[model samples]
Target: MFGTKVIETFKEEHTGDVLDMMRDFEVKKRAISEEKEGNIVLRIPAAFAETYKSLNSNPISKHIFKGRFTETTKLKRDKLNINVGVSKQFIARSVSNNIEHAKRILAENECSNISTILLVGGFAESEIVQERIREAFPNKRVIIPSESGCPQRSSSSWS
Candidate 1:
Protein backbone atom coordinates (compact mmCIF):
# COMPACT_ATOMS: atom_id res chain seq x y z
CA MET A 1 0.00 0.00 0.00
CA PHE A 2 2.42 2.67 -1.18
CA GLY A 3 0.71 4.97 -3.64
CA THR A 4 -2.98 4.59 -2.94
CA LYS A 5 -5.67 2.06 -2.24
CA VAL A 6 -5.95 1.13 -5.89
CA ILE A 7 -2.26 0.57 -6.30
CA GLU A 8 -2.04 -1.35 -3.07
CA THR A 9 -4.81 -3.67 -4.17
CA PHE A 10 -3.22 -4.10 -7.55
CA LYS A 11 0.08 -4.99 -6.02
CA GLU A 12 -1.59 -7.57 -3.83
CA GLU A 13 -2.52 -9.54 -6.88
CA HIS A 14 0.47 -11.80 -7.28
CA THR A 15 -0.17 -12.22 -11.01
CA GLY A 16 0.67 -8.61 -12.03
CA ASP A 17 -1.67 -8.66 -15.00
CA VAL A 18 -2.35 -4.95 -15.25
CA LEU A 19 1.29 -4.00 -15.05
CA ASP A 20 2.06 -6.40 -17.82
CA MET A 21 -0.60 -4.94 -20.11
CA MET A 22 0.74 -1.45 -19.65
CA ARG A 23 4.29 -2.58 -20.35
CA ASP A 24 3.10 -4.40 -23.43
CA PHE A 25 1.65 -1.15 -24.68
CA GLU A 26 4.94 0.57 -24.01
CA VAL A 27 6.78 -2.06 -26.00
CA LYS A 28 4.37 -1.68 -28.90
CA LYS A 29 4.55 2.09 -28.60
CA ARG A 30 8.32 1.91 -28.39
CA ALA A 31 8.16 4.29 -25.49
CA ILE A 32 10.81 2.06 -24.00
CA SER A 33 13.48 0.86 -26.39
CA GLU A 34 14.23 -2.83 -26.67
CA GLU A 35 17.88 -3.74 -27.29
CA LYS A 36 17.47 -7.50 -27.49
CA GLU A 37 15.83 -7.23 -30.94
CA GLY A 38 13.13 -9.76 -30.20
CA ASN A 39 9.66 -10.05 -28.73
CA ILE A 40 10.48 -9.81 -25.06
CA VAL A 41 8.40 -10.13 -21.95
CA LEU A 42 9.38 -9.62 -18.29
CA ARG A 43 7.86 -10.15 -14.87
CA ILE A 44 9.05 -8.64 -11.62
CA PRO A 45 7.51 -8.48 -8.18
CA ALA A 46 5.31 -5.50 -7.56
CA ALA A 47 6.49 -3.49 -4.61
CA PHE A 48 3.79 -3.12 -2.03
CA ALA A 49 3.99 -1.78 1.49
CA GLU A 50 3.65 -5.29 2.80
CA THR A 51 6.35 -6.57 0.49
CA TYR A 52 8.75 -3.93 1.78
CA LYS A 53 7.87 -4.81 5.30
CA SER A 54 8.66 -8.43 4.59
CA LEU A 55 11.90 -7.52 2.87
CA ASN A 56 12.94 -5.51 5.87
CA SER A 57 12.82 -8.64 7.99
CA ASN A 58 14.91 -10.72 5.62
CA PRO A 59 18.65 -11.35 5.92
CA ILE A 60 19.08 -9.48 2.63
CA SER A 61 18.13 -6.34 4.54
CA LYS A 62 21.42 -6.65 6.38
CA HIS A 63 23.22 -6.19 3.09
CA ILE A 64 20.76 -3.56 1.88
CA PHE A 65 21.21 -1.44 4.99
CA LYS A 66 24.93 -1.58 4.37
CA GLY A 67 24.32 -0.14 0.87
CA ARG A 68 24.84 -3.48 -0.77
CA PHE A 69 21.70 -4.70 -2.50
CA THR A 70 21.88 -7.98 -4.30
CA GLU A 71 19.60 -8.74 -7.22
CA THR A 72 19.33 -12.02 -9.04
CA THR A 73 19.08 -11.65 -12.79
CA LYS A 74 17.78 -14.73 -14.51
CA LEU A 75 18.46 -15.02 -18.21
CA LYS A 76 16.71 -17.85 -19.99
CA ARG A 77 19.16 -18.86 -22.66
CA ASP A 78 19.47 -22.35 -24.13
CA LYS A 79 19.54 -23.20 -20.42
CA LEU A 80 18.50 -21.29 -17.33
CA ASN A 81 21.22 -19.02 -16.13
CA ILE A 82 21.19 -16.86 -13.02
CA ASN A 83 23.60 -14.09 -12.07
CA VAL A 84 23.70 -12.13 -8.87
CA GLY A 85 25.01 -8.56 -8.46
CA VAL A 86 25.44 -6.38 -5.42
CA SER A 87 24.50 -2.74 -5.83
CA LYS A 88 25.93 0.23 -4.01
CA GLN A 89 22.44 0.98 -2.68
CA PHE A 90 19.07 -0.59 -2.23
CA ILE A 91 17.04 -0.80 -5.42
CA ALA A 92 13.60 -1.21 -3.80
CA ARG A 93 13.72 2.12 -1.99
CA SER A 94 12.44 4.36 -4.78
CA VAL A 95 12.11 4.28 -8.57
CA SER A 96 15.22 6.30 -9.33
CA ASN A 97 17.12 4.72 -6.50
CA ASN A 98 16.32 1.22 -7.73
CA ILE A 99 17.37 1.94 -11.29
CA GLU A 100 20.59 3.61 -10.23
CA HIS A 101 21.56 0.75 -7.99
CA ALA A 102 20.62 -1.77 -10.63
CA LYS A 103 22.89 0.04 -13.07
CA ARG A 104 25.81 0.06 -10.72
CA ILE A 105 25.41 -3.57 -9.87
CA LEU A 106 24.99 -4.58 -13.48
CA ALA A 107 28.00 -2.55 -14.56
CA GLU A 108 30.16 -4.26 -12.00
CA ASN A 109 29.04 -7.77 -12.85
CA GLU A 110 27.54 -7.89 -16.35
CA CYS A 111 30.83 -8.53 -18.08
CA SER A 112 31.72 -11.42 -15.85
CA ASN A 113 28.28 -12.84 -15.09
CA ILE A 114 25.40 -11.89 -17.37
CA SER A 115 24.83 -11.05 -21.03
CA THR A 116 21.64 -8.96 -20.67
CA ILE A 117 19.39 -7.39 -18.07
CA LEU A 118 15.64 -7.47 -18.14
CA LEU A 119 13.82 -4.50 -16.69
CA VAL A 120 10.33 -5.22 -15.46
CA GLY A 121 7.82 -4.53 -12.72
CA GLY A 122 6.18 -1.14 -12.15
CA PHE A 123 9.30 0.98 -11.81
CA ALA A 124 10.78 -0.31 -15.05
CA GLU A 125 8.63 2.07 -17.11
CA SER A 126 10.43 5.25 -16.12
CA GLU A 127 12.75 6.46 -18.90
CA ILE A 128 15.17 8.03 -16.48
CA VAL A 129 14.91 4.78 -14.54
CA GLN A 130 16.05 2.45 -17.29
CA GLU A 131 18.57 4.98 -18.64
CA ARG A 132 20.63 4.82 -15.50
CA ILE A 133 20.63 1.06 -15.72
CA ARG A 134 21.67 1.16 -19.38
CA GLU A 135 24.35 3.80 -18.97
CA ALA A 136 26.03 1.88 -16.21
CA PHE A 137 26.01 -1.45 -18.02
CA PRO A 138 26.38 -0.47 -21.64
CA ASN A 139 28.20 -3.62 -22.62
CA LYS A 140 25.44 -5.88 -21.35
CA ARG A 141 22.25 -6.02 -23.40
CA VAL A 142 19.02 -4.65 -21.90
CA ILE A 143 15.54 -5.72 -22.79
CA ILE A 144 12.08 -4.72 -21.61
CA PRO A 145 9.58 -7.20 -22.89
CA SER A 146 6.10 -6.57 -24.25
CA GLU A 147 3.87 -7.66 -21.40
CA SER A 148 0.13 -8.03 -21.86
CA GLY A 149 -1.05 -9.45 -18.58
CA CYS A 150 1.11 -10.88 -15.87
CA PRO A 151 4.72 -9.64 -15.94
CA GLN A 152 6.00 -13.09 -16.87
CA ARG A 153 7.61 -13.26 -20.31
CA SER A 154 9.95 -15.49 -22.23
CA SER A 155 13.53 -15.75 -20.96
CA SER A 156 14.94 -15.92 -24.50
CA SER A 157 15.75 -12.20 -24.69
CA TRP A 158 18.83 -12.66 -22.59
CA SER A 159 20.41 -14.97 -25.11
Candidate 2:
Protein backbone atom coordinates (compact mmCIF):
# COMPACT_ATOMS: atom_id res chain seq x y z
CA MET A 1 0.00 0.00 0.00
CA PHE A 2 3.11 2.29 0.25
CA GLY A 3 2.77 3.65 -3.28
CA THR A 4 4.68 6.64 -4.67
CA LYS A 5 1.84 9.08 -4.10
CA VAL A 6 1.35 7.97 -0.50
CA ILE A 7 5.08 8.26 0.29
CA GLU A 8 5.42 11.64 -1.40
CA THR A 9 2.37 13.08 0.32
CA PHE A 10 3.64 11.90 3.71
CA LYS A 11 7.09 13.39 3.18
CA GLU A 12 5.58 16.74 2.22
CA GLU A 13 3.55 16.98 5.42
CA HIS A 14 5.75 15.32 8.04
CA THR A 15 7.88 17.51 10.37
CA GLY A 16 9.59 14.41 11.78
CA ASP A 17 9.97 13.06 15.30
CA VAL A 18 12.87 12.16 17.63
CA LEU A 19 12.63 8.49 16.67
CA ASP A 20 13.03 9.48 13.03
CA MET A 21 16.08 11.57 13.82
CA MET A 22 17.68 8.72 15.78
CA ARG A 23 16.87 6.26 13.00
CA ASP A 24 18.53 8.44 10.39
CA PHE A 25 21.70 8.86 12.49
CA GLU A 26 21.88 5.11 13.07
CA VAL A 27 21.55 4.43 9.35
CA LYS A 28 24.24 7.00 8.49
CA LYS A 29 26.72 5.45 10.92
CA ARG A 30 26.22 2.07 9.24
CA ALA A 31 26.48 3.57 5.78
CA ILE A 32 30.06 4.73 5.15
CA SER A 33 29.68 5.30 1.44
CA GLU A 34 30.13 8.95 0.43
CA GLU A 35 28.11 8.26 -2.73
CA LYS A 36 24.82 8.25 -0.75
CA GLU A 37 23.29 11.69 -0.47
CA GLY A 38 19.97 13.63 -0.48
CA ASN A 39 16.90 12.66 1.52
CA ILE A 40 17.04 9.25 3.20
CA VAL A 41 13.98 7.15 3.98
CA LEU A 42 13.82 4.52 6.70
CA ARG A 43 11.12 1.95 7.38
CA ILE A 44 10.17 1.66 11.03
CA PRO A 45 9.64 -1.99 11.80
CA ALA A 46 6.79 -3.01 14.10
CA ALA A 47 9.30 -4.49 16.55
CA PHE A 48 10.37 -0.95 17.50
CA ALA A 49 6.86 0.05 18.62
CA GLU A 50 7.62 -0.35 22.33
CA THR A 51 10.63 1.94 22.12
CA TYR A 52 8.87 4.58 19.99
CA LYS A 53 5.81 4.70 22.25
CA SER A 54 7.91 5.75 25.25
CA LEU A 55 8.77 9.13 23.63
CA ASN A 56 5.40 10.67 24.41
CA SER A 57 6.85 13.02 27.03
CA ASN A 58 9.75 14.30 24.89
CA PRO A 59 9.17 17.93 23.91
CA ILE A 60 11.47 17.53 20.95
CA SER A 61 9.59 14.49 19.62
CA LYS A 62 6.39 15.26 17.74
CA HIS A 63 3.39 13.04 17.18
CA ILE A 64 3.25 11.08 13.95
CA PHE A 65 0.73 12.90 11.67
CA LYS A 66 -2.13 10.55 12.69
CA GLY A 67 -3.30 8.54 9.67
CA ARG A 68 -0.04 9.29 7.91
CA PHE A 69 1.24 6.10 9.50
CA THR A 70 -0.53 2.89 8.58
CA GLU A 71 -1.39 0.42 11.32
CA THR A 72 0.31 -2.92 11.99
CA THR A 73 -0.85 -5.22 9.27
CA LYS A 74 -0.23 -8.95 8.98
CA LEU A 75 2.75 -8.24 6.73
CA LYS A 76 4.55 -6.54 9.64
CA ARG A 77 5.82 -3.88 7.24
CA ASP A 78 3.97 -0.77 8.38
CA LYS A 79 4.38 2.50 6.49
CA LEU A 80 5.37 5.34 8.84
CA ASN A 81 6.09 9.02 8.14
CA ILE A 82 9.06 10.70 9.80
CA ASN A 83 11.52 13.24 8.45
CA VAL A 84 14.95 14.00 9.92
CA GLY A 85 17.13 16.82 8.67
CA VAL A 86 20.85 16.20 8.92
CA SER A 87 23.64 18.45 7.75
CA LYS A 88 27.29 17.76 6.94
CA GLN A 89 28.10 20.55 9.39
CA PHE A 90 27.09 18.18 12.19
CA ILE A 91 29.82 15.69 11.28
CA ALA A 92 32.38 18.39 10.54
CA ARG A 93 31.71 20.08 13.87
CA SER A 94 32.07 16.81 15.81
CA VAL A 95 35.42 16.01 14.25
CA SER A 96 36.46 19.63 14.64
CA ASN A 97 35.71 19.47 18.35
CA ASN A 98 38.02 16.46 18.76
CA ILE A 99 40.72 18.17 16.75
CA GLU A 100 40.35 21.29 18.90
CA HIS A 101 40.63 19.15 22.01
CA ALA A 102 43.84 17.64 20.69
CA LYS A 103 45.13 21.13 19.98
CA ARG A 104 44.34 22.14 23.55
CA ILE A 105 46.18 19.13 25.00
CA LEU A 106 49.24 19.81 22.85
CA ALA A 107 49.22 23.50 23.78
CA GLU A 108 48.88 22.70 27.50
CA ASN A 109 51.88 20.36 27.34
CA GLU A 110 53.92 22.82 25.23
CA CYS A 111 54.14 20.20 22.48
CA SER A 112 52.38 22.22 19.84
CA ASN A 113 55.02 21.40 17.29
CA ILE A 114 53.67 17.89 16.74
CA SER A 115 54.59 16.23 13.44
CA THR A 116 53.22 12.72 12.95
CA ILE A 117 49.65 11.54 13.63
CA LEU A 118 48.67 7.87 13.64
CA LEU A 119 44.92 7.28 13.16
CA VAL A 120 44.02 3.74 14.27
CA GLY A 121 40.27 3.75 14.91
CA GLY A 122 37.48 2.84 12.50
CA PHE A 123 36.35 6.48 12.38
CA ALA A 124 39.86 7.23 11.21
CA GLU A 125 39.14 4.91 8.27
CA SER A 126 36.44 7.30 7.06
CA GLU A 127 37.54 9.07 3.88
CA ILE A 128 35.94 12.36 4.96
CA VAL A 129 37.66 12.10 8.33
CA GLN A 130 41.02 11.23 6.81
CA GLU A 131 40.71 14.15 4.42
CA ARG A 132 39.73 16.50 7.26
CA ILE A 133 42.69 15.41 9.36
CA ARG A 134 45.02 15.88 6.42
CA GLU A 135 43.63 19.37 5.78
CA ALA A 136 43.75 20.36 9.45
CA PHE A 137 47.35 19.22 9.93
CA PRO A 138 48.73 19.52 6.44
CA ASN A 139 52.32 19.87 7.56
CA LYS A 140 52.05 16.89 9.88
CA ARG A 141 52.13 13.26 8.70
CA VAL A 142 48.85 11.32 8.94
CA ILE A 143 49.15 7.58 8.61
CA ILE A 144 46.19 5.21 8.80
CA PRO A 145 47.20 1.61 8.48
CA SER A 146 45.22 -0.86 6.32
CA GLU A 147 44.34 -2.76 9.48
CA SER A 148 41.84 -0.12 10.51
CA GLY A 149 38.46 -1.52 9.45
CA CYS A 150 35.06 -0.68 10.98
CA PRO A 151 35.03 0.99 14.40
CA GLN A 152 34.50 -2.26 16.32
CA ARG A 153 37.10 -4.08 14.26
CA SER A 154 39.43 -1.10 14.35
CA SER A 155 39.31 -1.07 18.15
CA SER A 156 40.11 -4.79 18.47
CA SER A 157 42.72 -4.62 15.72
CA TRP A 158 44.56 -1.87 17.56
CA SER A 159 44.39 -3.89 20.75
Candidate 3:
Protein backbone atom coordinates (compact mmCIF):
# COMPACT_ATOMS: atom_id res chain seq x y z
CA MET A 1 0.00 0.00 0.00
CA PHE A 2 2.87 2.39 0.65
CA GLY A 3 4.47 1.91 -2.76
CA THR A 4 3.25 3.49 -5.96
CA LYS A 5 2.68 0.07 -7.50
CA VAL A 6 1.48 -3.31 -6.28
CA ILE A 7 3.90 -5.29 -4.07
CA GLU A 8 4.48 -8.04 -6.64
CA THR A 9 5.04 -5.41 -9.34
CA PHE A 10 7.54 -3.62 -7.15
CA LYS A 11 9.45 -6.82 -6.37
CA GLU A 12 9.45 -7.84 -10.02
CA GLU A 13 10.75 -4.46 -11.05
CA HIS A 14 13.21 -3.66 -8.27
CA THR A 15 14.33 -6.78 -6.41
CA GLY A 16 16.53 -8.20 -9.20
CA ASP A 17 18.46 -4.96 -9.57
CA VAL A 18 18.54 -4.32 -5.85
CA LEU A 19 20.03 -7.72 -5.12
CA ASP A 20 22.44 -7.78 -8.09
CA MET A 21 24.04 -4.49 -7.19
CA MET A 22 24.48 -5.65 -3.60
CA ARG A 23 26.28 -8.75 -4.83
CA ASP A 24 28.60 -6.78 -7.07
CA PHE A 25 29.98 -4.43 -4.38
CA GLU A 26 30.54 -7.24 -1.88
CA VAL A 27 32.82 -9.00 -4.34
CA LYS A 28 34.53 -5.97 -5.85
CA LYS A 29 35.54 -3.73 -2.91
CA ARG A 30 37.95 -6.27 -1.41
CA ALA A 31 39.99 -6.10 -4.63
CA ILE A 32 40.17 -2.29 -4.93
CA SER A 33 43.71 -1.25 -5.71
CA GLU A 34 46.00 1.51 -6.96
CA GLU A 35 46.28 -0.16 -10.38
CA LYS A 36 42.53 -0.44 -10.70
CA GLU A 37 40.31 2.60 -10.26
CA GLY A 38 37.05 1.08 -9.10
CA ASN A 39 33.75 2.80 -8.53
CA ILE A 40 33.08 4.04 -4.97
CA VAL A 41 30.09 2.32 -3.43
CA LEU A 42 27.70 2.24 -0.45
CA ARG A 43 25.44 -0.68 0.35
CA ILE A 44 21.76 -0.61 -0.53
CA PRO A 45 20.48 -0.16 3.01
CA ALA A 46 18.10 -2.61 4.64
CA ALA A 47 15.41 0.05 4.59
CA PHE A 48 15.45 -0.18 0.83
CA ALA A 49 13.30 -3.27 1.08
CA GLU A 50 10.78 -1.30 3.10
CA THR A 51 10.45 1.63 0.73
CA TYR A 52 12.19 3.11 -2.30
CA LYS A 53 11.81 6.61 -0.89
CA SER A 54 13.59 5.82 2.39
CA LEU A 55 17.06 6.77 1.17
CA ASN A 56 15.91 10.27 0.25
CA SER A 57 14.89 10.87 3.82
CA ASN A 58 17.83 9.34 5.65
CA PRO A 59 21.07 11.31 5.67
CA ILE A 60 23.65 9.63 7.89
CA SER A 61 22.75 6.09 6.77
CA LYS A 62 21.80 6.65 3.14
CA HIS A 63 24.63 6.68 0.59
CA ILE A 64 22.99 7.20 -2.80
CA PHE A 65 22.28 10.66 -4.01
CA LYS A 66 21.48 12.15 -7.43
CA GLY A 67 21.75 8.94 -9.46
CA ARG A 68 25.38 8.27 -8.50
CA PHE A 69 25.27 4.71 -7.10
CA THR A 70 26.38 1.70 -9.20
CA GLU A 71 26.50 -1.52 -7.10
CA THR A 72 25.71 -2.86 -3.63
CA THR A 73 27.33 -4.95 -0.89
CA LYS A 74 25.39 -6.95 1.66
CA LEU A 75 28.46 -8.98 2.51
CA LYS A 76 27.59 -8.87 6.18
CA ARG A 77 24.45 -10.54 7.36
CA ASP A 78 22.99 -7.29 8.69
CA LYS A 79 24.66 -4.60 6.61
CA LEU A 80 24.05 -2.80 3.31
CA ASN A 81 26.51 -1.38 0.74
CA ILE A 82 26.34 0.47 -2.57
CA ASN A 83 28.91 0.90 -5.34
CA VAL A 84 29.95 4.43 -6.25
CA GLY A 85 31.92 5.92 -9.16
CA VAL A 86 33.76 8.79 -7.57
CA SER A 87 36.20 10.86 -9.63
CA LYS A 88 39.89 10.11 -9.24
CA GLN A 89 40.63 13.78 -9.00
CA PHE A 90 38.17 14.03 -6.14
CA ILE A 91 39.94 11.30 -4.23
CA ALA A 92 43.23 13.07 -4.75
CA ARG A 93 41.83 16.35 -3.52
CA SER A 94 40.29 14.74 -0.46
CA VAL A 95 43.53 13.00 0.41
CA SER A 96 45.37 16.24 -0.09
CA ASN A 97 43.03 18.03 2.26
CA ASN A 98 43.45 15.42 4.96
CA ILE A 99 47.21 15.46 4.58
CA GLU A 100 47.27 19.23 4.79
CA HIS A 101 45.19 19.16 7.93
CA ALA A 102 47.44 16.61 9.58
CA LYS A 103 50.52 18.61 8.66
CA ARG A 104 48.98 21.74 10.08
CA ILE A 105 48.27 19.96 13.34
CA LEU A 106 51.80 18.61 13.46
CA ALA A 107 53.25 22.03 12.81
CA GLU A 108 51.10 23.54 15.51
CA ASN A 109 52.43 20.91 17.88
CA GLU A 110 56.03 21.80 16.89
CA CYS A 111 56.56 18.54 15.03
CA SER A 112 57.12 20.13 11.64
CA ASN A 113 60.27 18.06 11.20
CA ILE A 114 58.51 14.74 11.63
CA SER A 115 59.59 12.26 8.96
CA THR A 116 57.14 9.37 8.98
CA ILE A 117 53.35 9.26 8.66
CA LEU A 118 51.22 6.40 9.84
CA LEU A 119 47.70 6.15 8.46
CA VAL A 120 45.70 4.21 11.03
CA GLY A 121 42.01 4.91 10.52
CA GLY A 122 39.64 2.72 8.55
CA PHE A 123 40.32 5.00 5.60
CA ALA A 124 43.94 3.99 5.92
CA GLU A 125 42.97 0.58 4.52
CA SER A 126 42.09 2.16 1.19
CA GLU A 127 44.54 1.61 -1.66
CA ILE A 128 43.65 5.00 -3.08
CA VAL A 129 44.53 6.69 0.18
CA GLN A 130 47.73 4.69 0.42
CA GLU A 131 48.66 5.62 -3.13
CA ARG A 132 47.94 9.28 -2.53
CA ILE A 133 50.01 9.29 0.64
CA ARG A 134 52.94 7.77 -1.22
CA GLU A 135 52.61 10.26 -4.06
CA ALA A 136 52.09 13.28 -1.87
CA PHE A 137 54.83 12.50 0.60
CA PRO A 138 57.51 11.12 -1.65
CA ASN A 139 60.17 12.29 0.82
CA LYS A 140 58.51 10.81 3.89
CA ARG A 141 57.87 7.24 4.99
CA VAL A 142 54.23 6.18 5.20
CA ILE A 143 53.21 3.21 7.31
CA ILE A 144 49.91 1.38 7.05
CA PRO A 145 49.00 -1.90 8.71
CA SER A 146 47.22 -4.55 6.69
CA GLU A 147 44.14 -4.81 8.90
CA SER A 148 41.04 -2.63 8.71
CA GLY A 149 40.58 -0.14 11.54
CA CYS A 150 36.99 -1.02 12.37
CA PRO A 151 36.36 -4.45 10.92
CA GLN A 152 33.06 -5.03 12.64
CA ARG A 153 31.30 -1.82 11.64
CA SER A 154 28.53 -2.08 9.11
CA SER A 155 28.14 -0.21 5.77
CA SER A 156 29.69 2.81 4.05
CA SER A 157 33.07 3.69 2.51
CA TRP A 158 35.07 6.88 1.94
CA SER A 159 34.50 8.00 -1.64
Candidate 4:
Protein backbone atom coordinates (compact mmCIF):
# COMPACT_ATOMS: atom_id res chain seq x y z
CA MET A 1 0.00 0.00 0.00
CA PHE A 2 0.94 3.67 -0.36
CA GLY A 3 1.08 4.12 3.41
CA THR A 4 3.58 1.27 3.72
CA LYS A 5 5.88 2.92 1.19
CA VAL A 6 5.63 6.22 3.00
CA ILE A 7 6.56 4.63 6.29
CA GLU A 8 9.43 2.78 4.64
CA THR A 9 10.72 5.98 3.13
CA PHE A 10 10.41 7.79 6.43
CA LYS A 11 12.35 5.07 8.24
CA GLU A 12 15.06 4.93 5.59
CA GLU A 13 15.52 8.70 5.30
CA HIS A 14 14.24 10.69 8.27
CA THR A 15 14.21 8.24 11.17
CA GLY A 16 17.79 7.13 10.62
CA ASP A 17 19.01 10.73 10.58
CA VAL A 18 17.25 11.58 13.84
CA LEU A 19 18.52 8.44 15.54
CA ASP A 20 22.01 9.18 14.28
CA MET A 21 21.85 12.59 15.98
CA MET A 22 21.12 10.86 19.30
CA ARG A 23 23.86 8.28 18.74
CA ASP A 24 26.50 10.25 20.66
CA PHE A 25 24.30 10.43 23.75
CA GLU A 26 24.88 6.66 24.29
CA VAL A 27 21.17 5.99 23.82
CA LYS A 28 21.42 2.23 24.33
CA LYS A 29 17.68 1.92 24.95
CA ARG A 30 15.17 2.45 22.16
CA ALA A 31 11.56 1.58 21.50
CA ILE A 32 9.45 1.95 18.38
CA SER A 33 5.76 1.47 17.79
CA GLU A 34 3.31 2.06 14.98
CA GLU A 35 0.32 4.31 15.58
CA LYS A 36 -3.09 4.06 13.99
CA GLU A 37 -2.67 7.19 11.89
CA GLY A 38 0.25 5.87 9.87
CA ASN A 39 2.63 7.39 12.36
CA ILE A 40 5.74 5.79 13.80
CA VAL A 41 6.60 6.42 17.43
CA LEU A 42 10.09 6.67 18.86
CA ARG A 43 10.65 6.78 22.57
CA ILE A 44 13.88 8.11 24.00
CA PRO A 45 15.32 7.58 27.47
CA ALA A 46 14.26 10.42 29.79
CA ALA A 47 12.28 11.09 32.94
CA PHE A 48 9.56 12.70 30.83
CA ALA A 49 8.13 9.32 29.82
CA GLU A 50 7.58 8.24 33.43
CA THR A 51 5.96 11.56 34.30
CA TYR A 52 3.73 11.30 31.27
CA LYS A 53 2.54 7.88 32.42
CA SER A 54 1.79 9.25 35.87
CA LEU A 55 -0.09 12.24 34.45
CA ASN A 56 -2.27 9.82 32.50
CA SER A 57 -3.19 7.86 35.65
CA ASN A 58 -3.73 10.91 37.86
CA PRO A 59 -6.04 13.66 36.63
CA ILE A 60 -4.95 16.09 39.34
CA SER A 61 -1.39 16.13 37.95
CA LYS A 62 -2.53 16.96 34.43
CA HIS A 63 -0.18 19.27 32.57
CA ILE A 64 -1.25 22.11 30.29
CA PHE A 65 0.49 20.65 27.29
CA LYS A 66 -0.01 17.00 26.49
CA GLY A 67 3.61 16.41 25.48
CA ARG A 68 5.47 19.12 27.36
CA PHE A 69 6.25 18.43 30.98
CA THR A 70 7.39 15.31 32.84
CA GLU A 71 8.08 15.58 36.54
CA THR A 72 10.33 13.20 38.44
CA THR A 73 11.44 12.92 42.05
CA LYS A 74 14.58 11.21 43.31
CA LEU A 75 15.97 10.63 46.75
CA LYS A 76 19.59 11.41 47.48
CA ARG A 77 21.04 10.74 50.90
CA ASP A 78 17.51 10.84 52.37
CA LYS A 79 16.75 14.12 50.57
CA LEU A 80 13.90 14.22 48.08
CA ASN A 81 14.58 16.24 44.93
CA ILE A 82 12.14 16.89 42.14
CA ASN A 83 12.97 17.60 38.49
CA VAL A 84 10.40 18.92 36.05
CA GLY A 85 10.65 19.23 32.29
CA VAL A 86 10.69 22.77 30.84
CA SER A 87 11.67 22.04 27.28
CA LYS A 88 8.28 22.01 25.60
CA GLN A 89 6.85 25.31 24.28
CA PHE A 90 3.96 25.68 26.70
CA ILE A 91 6.12 24.95 29.74
CA ALA A 92 9.00 27.05 28.44
CA ARG A 93 7.20 30.26 29.36
CA SER A 94 7.10 29.19 33.00
CA VAL A 95 10.72 28.14 33.50
CA SER A 96 11.16 30.44 36.46
CA ASN A 97 7.95 29.16 38.05
CA ASN A 98 9.12 25.58 37.55
CA ILE A 99 12.45 26.37 39.20
CA GLU A 100 10.56 27.89 42.14
CA HIS A 101 8.40 24.81 42.34
CA ALA A 102 11.50 22.65 42.47
CA LYS A 103 13.00 24.73 45.24
CA ARG A 104 9.74 24.58 47.23
CA ILE A 105 9.61 20.81 46.83
CA LEU A 106 13.19 20.49 48.04
CA ALA A 107 12.41 22.70 50.99
CA GLU A 108 9.21 20.85 51.88
CA ASN A 109 11.11 17.55 51.95
CA GLU A 110 13.45 19.04 54.59
CA CYS A 111 16.46 18.15 52.40
CA SER A 112 19.00 20.67 53.59
CA ASN A 113 21.66 18.10 52.84
CA ILE A 114 20.83 17.94 49.17
CA SER A 115 23.78 17.98 46.82
CA THR A 116 23.45 19.16 43.21
CA ILE A 117 20.52 20.31 41.07
CA LEU A 118 20.35 18.64 37.68
CA LEU A 119 18.77 20.14 34.55
CA VAL A 120 18.10 17.85 31.65
CA GLY A 121 16.14 17.94 28.37
CA GLY A 122 16.34 20.51 25.57
CA PHE A 123 15.39 23.60 27.61
CA ALA A 124 18.35 22.97 29.84
CA GLU A 125 20.54 23.93 26.88
CA SER A 126 19.13 27.43 26.59
CA GLU A 127 21.39 30.21 27.80
CA ILE A 128 18.48 32.26 29.12
CA VAL A 129 17.08 29.33 31.09
CA GLN A 130 20.49 28.48 32.52
CA GLU A 131 21.14 32.08 33.51
CA ARG A 132 17.77 32.34 35.21
CA ILE A 133 18.40 29.15 37.16
CA ARG A 134 21.86 30.33 38.15
CA GLU A 135 20.43 33.62 39.36
CA ALA A 136 17.79 31.82 41.41
CA PHE A 137 20.07 29.19 42.96
CA PRO A 138 23.43 30.85 43.08
CA ASN A 139 24.84 28.45 45.68
CA LYS A 140 23.39 25.20 44.34
CA ARG A 141 25.39 23.17 41.87
CA VAL A 142 23.56 22.79 38.57
CA ILE A 143 24.60 19.87 36.40
CA ILE A 144 23.99 19.55 32.68
CA PRO A 145 25.21 16.75 30.49
CA SER A 146 27.99 17.47 27.97
CA GLU A 147 27.19 14.98 25.23
CA SER A 148 23.57 16.00 24.77
CA GLY A 149 23.91 15.90 20.96
CA CYS A 150 22.57 18.30 18.32
CA PRO A 151 19.73 18.33 15.83
CA GLN A 152 20.38 16.70 12.46
CA ARG A 153 19.74 17.93 8.95
CA SER A 154 19.88 16.10 5.64
CA SER A 155 23.42 15.96 4.26
CA SER A 156 22.70 14.05 1.08
CA SER A 157 22.20 17.20 -0.94
CA TRP A 158 25.70 18.40 -0.16
CA SER A 159 27.27 15.74 -2.24
Each model's C-alpha lDDT? 0.46, 0.53, 0.57, 0.46
Higher-scoring candidate on lDDT, 1 or 3 = 3
For residue 81, give model 3's deviation from the true position in Å: 9.9
Compute the lDDT of residue 118 as modeled in candidate 3.
84
In what order do the candidates fall by TM-score, top score first?
2, 3, 4, 1
Against the hidden true structure, what lDDT does model 3 obtain?
A: 0.57
TM-score of 3: 0.49
- Tell me each candidate's RMSD, in Å, in order: 16.3, 11.3, 11.3, 17.7
Report the number of the highest-lDDT candidate.
Answer: 3
Where model 4 places Cα greater than 4 Å from the true spot, the runs are 1-92, 149-159
Runs in model 1 lying further than 4 Å from the true structure: 1-96, 103-111, 152-159
Give the per-residue lDDT digits (tens) of candidate 1, residues 63-122: 222122123423232121212111112222354666566657656854457788888755
Clashes of each: 4, 0, 13, 0
lDDT value for model 2: 0.53
Q: Over the stretch 21-102, how does candidate 2's per-residue lDDT look in tens digits?
A: 4556555543443554544345554334333433334221233333523332222234332222233445567779978887
Measured by TM-score, how close is model 4 to the native structure?
A: 0.36
At residue 120, candidate 3 shows an lDDT of 81
